[model samples]
Target: MLLKSPWSPRLAGVEGTLCDRLVASLSEDILSGTLSGGDRLPAHRELAWSLGIGTGSVTKAYAVLERQGLIRGIKGRGTFVSVGSARRDALIDLSTNTLPLMLTDKLLSRTLSAISRRIDSDHVNLHPPAVGHDEHRRLLARWLGRQCVEACPEQLILTGSGQQALWLAFDILCGGRGIIVTERIGYSGALALARHRGHPLCAIGMDVEGMCPEDLDRELRDHDSNGRRRLVYVTPTVQNPTTRTMGAARRQAIVDICRRHATPIVEDGVYTLGNDPSLPPLVHLWPEGVFHVSSLSKSLSNGLRLGVLLAPPQGIAQARSALEAIPMTSSPVDYALLEEWVSNGVADSLRDSLRGEALRRNNLARDILKDRPLLTDDSAFHLWWPMPHARAEALAASALERGVSVTAPNAVRTDPEDDESGIRLCLGGPSRAEVERGLSVLAQLTSDG
Candidate 1:
């Protein structure tokens, strides 16, 4: 008699069927500690034959497990159980996650074609200069100039990634003893960087429009009395954690304030692309005082690690000098690949696809969280939901118990005293089915009286 299988029918293909069973079996084994951490699994063909399935099925199963973090596949070596699989029992990773919607095989094929064309011309590994290849820089600068018409290509500088650009800006502009004003709840990366550099972080208040102008003024005034200058950092478009976008009026007010005080605003517009085109960047409004940072990671593949920094005309030389002091140059191969993608319109296609996927996930969240109070912008990739009964950590822990991972507010806060009770759920990180199931699990946990 054939053995009864506990796998789901939703996974259909031969490989999917085999993978489903293997994942089910492996999940149980891992949880039971039978397949302990660092234990290697049998070879693909070996496992397939033993399980009475095709080798392709075994491969697919392994891929599923790898994506789920149950296993880690070494390039040459065999696959082994992940170290933290057991410890991840009660953690839902709704934090620091992203998913690509437009990474279609067609787009991949086109990108590969473009890359192959470049490789055929023998332009793969040649490092052009510290800044970047002139062609790539011009292309990117042209694109940015069109996006934010106020700034020209002369003001833009290329970096390896958005985080790197931010670091460079901090180092060049807000050196020793300066105050960096940020939102009470903001991107933790900026906060961590500030703390690491030993700069004082003045947490300012924010409203639906983003940083309150009055609070910004107050912080500036307070810092002025202390004989220190202040630099402001903000993510005006689709602000992380809160998923709130700053409007035009607020943008004008911020620009006006920066101009008046000569305060430099490092505006993170990483997520601004692939959204509604009408949302103008602050850099466009306050070109003299605003420093703009953006990246292609969220829209395209994160592996590229390409970022563009647009500084004021006067600050460009200083910014480039600071960047050279740290990471002098980014990988040429990555830049070439990114430039090829951008030239072929593959990047834009991917952005559109990712945006649509984010919308669908947001819709799913709306349906599941209909009764619950959640903060989300239609254009953002993540949502912020407050748990009524449990603290953010408790809720995250509870969700993790059900095999879902999420990030609590505390994980993203610079100060422990900051609000410790909300969670940021990334709609882009997991597969759609996985997100649906995960959100269902979360809804159950949060709904429990």
Candidate 2:
């Protein structure tokens, strides 16, 4: 909801006081939560037409709002409200891939303590099925179905982590030797695995919205459809390295392309924090060919090492068989704990808290790096900036020297020849003050050198 009502900005009195009235209306809406933290307001021209007031009023109101930290104007992008400041910690680290602890840690500790006391007598089956054929699969499926995916037990294969799920997806979908196409800038771990196994990665082009469907179609066409095409991997939501999310239409287009080509798609939701019912996973669109891999690592605790791979019945069975050989299977204790969390709504509660924290963190990042055009999604724990490859390296080094750590473009680039630079600033690890300090250093370096 951008604005509750058109011409809702209270217009009282004559031309001279229009700006003041407009500001009051906006302020009231913001305080009432009708206009949320990241909600974009109507453009000045459009609002003027609706309210029959001068555009100057809107502009003036925006200026005053910006100074008060109530709102901010992103160039080219619209104006959004500020969620206020973040809490500060000791050292600032922008390189972490993990999230801040929400309620999961406290819940986990309490659960573990209870489990330890009960572990004495009858808890013999400490090793659950690594393939997740039992309770874990059923519970997880029901929990995940909340995302509008509607997964079944037969279609879910449990793994130690999302990376493990990816490994299984690659083996089942690609047979270890075809072609694995992914976004040009993607998850470094997956890219590293592709390189290690000698899989020729066809890096597709991406923009702020995410992997371009036209570019993906082009890349798919160039390769021998029957011989080379294996799996097309993507992090559609909260995409790594660049915090870009594909809109519903873009995802549909990509799904249509893959479905037509008979290509198996690996959909990574490793870092996706939101379970927005509107943007369902690609697997929901085409369960037969789309393999959705997600984990509790981002939303819950990383140390739990609990991840699930959902595909069609046949596809998940094939992947599940490969899981038998992997040493890092979910322990029965942890599996049972995860099952309890899902069944009792603990996971959902924790996820909700994490989502709120992420929003707060994103707001902090926006306020800190607002001057530079940084890529960010509202619920993401990270921010990205596009720069020259060389400049990215220099800035990262400078940031590190100044006690702020960051990951630059080369780390996530799929091509060795790619010289385009970018930086991924993680906002989840540090406190508000620490992140502000780190961002200040990076911003100064970027602006100066």
Candidate 3:
């Protein structure tokens, strides 16, 4: 008779068969360090009884895990996790910036409980305004206060995602007619959004601090013609694709230049929540001219799909009107759970945990790529690894063959003048050990460069 297993596994979230989900759950648990080497899985019949599934399903799950090098079975003993099996020849992806599962899984039980107590009233409103519910906005405002930013519910426009937030900003502030100025290699999401809106992106030159002020001033002054509205989009802290930030003085200079040319700025502060405390948001400096867009997707959880576009009191009405056509707001269920989390202080704890993990992964990447040209931050979720454009491309291809994934050079390049060299490595996904393994493969490739 097979002995009983001590682990409890469930199949939920994302679509897949029962056996497949079981395999994925086991694999993920091992990678996350929740399950370690020599840990024995339950006997096929025993697990099937516990999970209320067919014994064959459990047997199939075991086979899949064994084939993936996740578990090994002995003739006399039950299946056990192989030694150092979690880091097997699986695809180590450093391309997606996402929160670890363990962190996001903390609030799910509470969220389900809270959501079950609510009653549906969709029949009450045939068409709700895109401004979103007042209660959610109030909660968002309260939460943002912790970040040293102030806003009222009237000035907040809730969006479905950060991408939608950028779209709303472009629609209302820029009107999609004038030239949009941005850093030479800026956030990939913002670049795609601008391109989709058919706006000309004037990619400015940059330094270590990001987005050169002199280049921005020239771009603004040169395009100050025919009464065309010019908009400057920037990510000042923990910038994506480059992982660099602008100092206070550099930020002030950019704001001053925008003011001189009367050009409005859309400050993408999505990546600043986990950044240094000393760096203040640009909206604090010039609220009227800055359209600040941020989201819980980065800080809390990506699947939440909740973002806020906070405008100054003077511009809130117009911003609200622009979203009227699209109705780009968060859903009732999403907002309710996010509010519950915020009210109970779960969001803050989650943010802190995520920041800690990001730092750990960043350190691992630093160690692997030691003495190489790296652009990184202690709090940021990703880094910039610079190499010759051609070499970067070749190395990226090689990395793919070695089962490592990374962002290519052209994906984040803002302009033709920008060098095609370098690739952005996201250090947020997977575990610290997994990130280190991926970076080791990349380190060998970097040695050639």
Candidate 4:
């Protein structure tokens, strides 16, 4: 007698074609542990008869499962879950930091369809102004107003991504000659950019409040005496990797230090989206002295790739010129679609949902690692697990061996000589269950001999 498959998913209410839904249901079961590795599945005709679906659909679904390494079949024998499927499914990823899937396929399709209907054929062919289309900029300006950053559309220059915005800022402010100063452990992307461009980078110290004010004041004083142009980049809210937020006093101190030396500050507000605007960004605190760079990649979806550069009045001309100098500008279609989303309140809804998810994941992490020394805020989707240098290395390696992926230690370090060591656990990319499993494995690894 052939072994009957345990598959019984409700197809009456599920979306997608029979085959697609079948594939999705089976995949979910296998990944969720409802279907274990090595469990035998019913033959195509058997499953088709039991599920009341066509045999062809069952065959296609099984073929897809095989391609995904979720199941296998042997000649003259029924299909069975692949022995490695459980391990593959159990391999949790906590390395990427971004909001979960707030932008669903249906929502994106609807938004794109609406944009297509409104935009004319000629408009599609024409290149938008290097600074961005006036309408798009106006919508963005309104969004900025909500964030409490007062700016007209002209000050907001569109870019491909937050990284691109940083590149443009560095090009204009540093001009390949100025020194870049940031916290000892800062955004890896910014640090890598400075190195790639051969710009000198100075690493300052940080405390519980983040970016030690004294260290920054001292560095700026020295660079000022030498007459070296300097750009201070900071992530005030939910600071990357460390997940520390600067207090109002610290923000004022940072602004004062920069102002005293007449240096420009590039405020990375990418992580500030969906966060409390009451704290205000460094740019808002000192608009004339700060260049604010932000994007939708963090708060909504990385695929958005919609970035904005809020340059000070004095640097507007230079920033716009730098943007136009680049051979490519942001996609007009993307901007149009984003404008629709924002106007329709879809963007705001997604942002609010993401904020809620971040809170859920952060709480879960804190609970899982309750006894461990953790550095993270309620709004942050990642946490810092502090440990000795050698121990951090060992912990990361050990966690991987047990099927948990984590960020490498050196990725966020600004100075190789700096002794501070820790691992960054990103909780945004994975599902809640995956996060729980991954964090449980990490907790176990940290407790082991």
Compared with the true structure, the alpha-carbon lDDT of candidate 2 equals: 0.72
**1 against 4, candidate with superior TM-score:** 4
Residue 143, candidate 3: C-alpha displacement in angstroms: 1.7
- Local distance difference test scores for all models: 0.69, 0.72, 0.75, 0.78
Runs off by more than 4 Å, candidate 4: 1-90, 120-123, 223-228
Query: What digit string (tens of lDDT, one per residue) describes model 3 on residues 157-270?
Result: 888887788888887877867678888877766776777677778888878999899888887777544665778899988788788889999989999999888888898877
The TM-score measured for candidate 1 stands at: 0.75
Kindly provide the TM-score of model 4 when superposed on the true structure, using C-alpha atoms: 0.77
Provide C-alpha RMSD values for all models, in order: 11.4, 19.4, 11.6, 12.0
lDDT of 4: 0.78
Clash count, one per candidate: 11, 4, 2, 0
TM-score of 3: 0.76
lDDT per residue as tens, model 1, 172-204: 677765778888777766776677678887777
**Candidate 2 residue-wise lDDT, 171-282, digit = tens:** 8877767689889887877886776566788888888778999998987777674665478999988898788888899889999999888888999987656656788688
lDDT of 4 by residue, 8-42 (tens): 64442222246655765666566657788888887
Which has the higher lDDT value, candidate number 2 or candidate number 4? 4
Index of the highest-lDDT prediction: 4
